[model samples]
Target: MFKSILVPFDGSQGAEAALAKAAELARLCGAELTLLTVYRHHSLLEASMHMVRPDEPADLDDIMRTHAKEVAERGRALAAESGIPAPRAFVKGGPVARTITSFAKEHGNDLTVIGSRGLGSLEGVLLGSVSHKVTSLSETPVLVV
Candidate 1:
């Protein structure tokens, strides 16, 4: 019974699955489907480390933002192919989970369908995945696919 559904996409297999599921839900409920892709703003120090030249410099944040837009558009296209009437897509630069939850809240999304790799690695077990963080941070209902 969602009026609007949000799916965070990052060109990952898990995210693809979530997008498909969200599209199905939106179609069934006659709801709006939204796609969001978030990229982290790279620190200057981190960006500098990969520099191969002293004269020429690269803007990692801009590069990431541009890539994020492409990913978001791809997600939108996928949703359209899934038979959604129109899927709105957005790209932001920030911490992924917080950005996703904040976008959902800001857009009045009734439901959020996110993806999880479901990895059982010690790092994930100790730190948790983005999906887990989204569930904890979001006030709206979240479905992890």
Candidate 2:
């Protein structure tokens, strides 16, 4: 019953598996798929500021954006190869969970498909789990494939 599906990709093996699943679901349902990749807006060095070199350029924002775009492009290619025509691809900068939720809301997505490892809980706290937060906060359905 899903008309639109959102799949977030991080270029990891888990994410690739999720993307394949999303593509299959979209193809089966004849639904539109949006492939999204999010890159957080800072680097470890930038966050720490421990070794700041005067001459070394620190365009962390641009770097993150570029990386996100590259990931999105790869996802797009995969979808295209799978015969999913013109799957929408977007790169966003922010916390993964919030960005994914906002993108789904903005796009009116009916379902989200993501990998479980991407939502791992570690050290008594979910460290980098976008799927967990999105499932908790999103009003739409989330399928952790």
Candidate 3:
């Protein structure tokens, strides 16, 4: 019964499963599917650690955004193959859980399908998993795979 469906994908196995599930739901409900890849903003100190030289300039935000775009594209392709037509994808920079939930709310998506575990391990254990946070924050229904 969903009009629009949102899936938070991170190129992880769990995320892939969630995407597949979302695709099936979209296909059955005739709903549009949107794949979202969330990346955290990197600080100067964090960007510097990846640099090999003092003179080297790191465009960490751009790099991360590019990577997130790729991840979203992959999810979109998978959804297409699963019979979800015209699936759209987006890359956003922010806190992962908040970004996902806010995007779903802002877009008026009726349902959100997300992975129970993503790339985060320490943060998941310490602060709770992103899926858990999303379920707590989102007003829409969330299905964690």
Candidate 4:
């Protein structure tokens, strides 16, 4: 039985499906649940694309972090609604697969339940999906929904 379960969520339908599965497992095992949302670091060019003002320089990291936090919190709320009590949420900026695996290891999570697909870039489609990379990299077992 899993004692700690991690779910990497991206606010997509696939992620929601994974979350539902993870929540059920958590409830069954009486495990602690954590919802993780990872956002990529924005380069200056990418940041400029999202800038609100033409001349104003916004802190892209902060902007992205805030949005990521919201995504995590939403996932936590969904878990709670699914009867998973007090689910924890975390947001980080990094390569999606690496960040998820690192967080699971760092937090001593016993299992990871993730979506088959997420809001991945074209590069991910060309190379491999984030879920695929996570499954390959993680020592803990990964269940792809």
Candidate 5:
């Protein structure tokens, strides 16, 4: 019954499971699947600043964008090969939960699929869990795979 399904991926195994589930659901329902990958811009910048020497120059935004694009490409390819219709790829820079919720609202997606991980209990309390946040905050139905 879903017209549009949004699947968020991060090149992790958990994300792969979510993508597979979303692809199957899309195929079964003849729905359009959208593969979303949110690049944690702030985190990446902080990481770059910590890893790189102060004197060294680095384009943190560009680097993170490239990585996000690659992750999206991989997810898109997998969905396409699995018989999901031409999956659209999106890359955003923000907190994962906010980005996902905003995308689902903006796209009018019937369903949002995301993997559970990355944010453990301690991390969830600190940074928050993307999947849990989306599930609790999203207006649309969210399936954590």
Candidate 6:
């Protein structure tokens, strides 16, 4: 039985499906459910590529982090609605799959549940889905929904 379950959420339909499944498992096992939303860190170099504008976000990383926080909260709400009263949620910026695995390891998660496909860029399609990469990289057991 899983004591702790981690779900990597990205505001995608696939991710929402994974969250629902993970929450169901957590409830069945009476496990603690954790949600994480990771945003891609945009370096200054990448920021410079975009045309500067007064209305545009001055710091892309900050904007990304802000959006990530919203996504995390939404996931938390979903988990709460699913039966877990108060699920823990977090927001981070980094390489998505690596960050997820690292967070799971750091937090001593027994199970990681993720979506088979998510809101990934073309790179994901070219290389592999985040779930695929996480399955390959993670030492903990991963369940892809």
**What's the CA RMSD of model 3 in angstroms?**
1.7
Instruction: Write the candidate numbers in order of decreasing lDDT.
Output: 4, 6, 3, 1, 5, 2
lDDT of 2 by residue, 42-78 (tens): 7576856635665555676887799789989999999
Candidates, ranked, TM-score = 6, 4, 3, 1, 2, 5
Error of 4 at 75 (Å): 0.5
- The per-residue C-alpha lDDT of model 6 at residue 134 equals 97
Candidate 2: pairs in clash: none
Identify the runs in model 4 with alpha carbons over 4 angstroms from their true place. 47-53
Superposed Cα deviation of residue 7, candidate 4 (Å): 0.3
> How does residue 69 of candidate 4 score in lDDT?
89
Q: Is candidate 4 or candidate 6 better by TM-score?
A: 6
lDDT of 1: 0.88
Per-residue alpha-carbon lDDT of model 6 for 1-145, expressed as tens digits? Answer: 9999999999999999999999989989999999999999886777776665556767888888898999999999989998996899999888999999999999999999999989989999899899999999999999999
Alpha-carbon runs more than 4 Å astray in model 1: 50-52, 55-57, 118-126
Model 4 pairs whose backbones collide: none
- Candidate 5 positional error at 77, Å: 0.3
Per-prediction TM-score to the true structure, in the order listed: 0.89, 0.88, 0.93, 0.93, 0.87, 0.94
Count clashing residue pairs in model 6: 0
- Write the residue-wise lDDT of candidate 3 on 1-145 in tens digits: 8999999999999999999899888888989999999999986777768765656556778888998989989888998888887899999999999999999999999999998888886868998999999999999999999
lDDT of each: 0.88, 0.85, 0.91, 0.93, 0.85, 0.92
Q: Report the Cα lDDT for candidate 3.
A: 0.91
Model 6, TM vs. native: 0.94
List model 4 lDDT by residue over 1-145, tens digit each: 8999999999999999999999999999999999999999987787767555656556778888998988998999999999998899999889889999999999999999999988988999899999999999999999999
- Give all candidate RMSDs, comma-separated: 2.7, 2.6, 1.7, 1.9, 2.7, 1.4
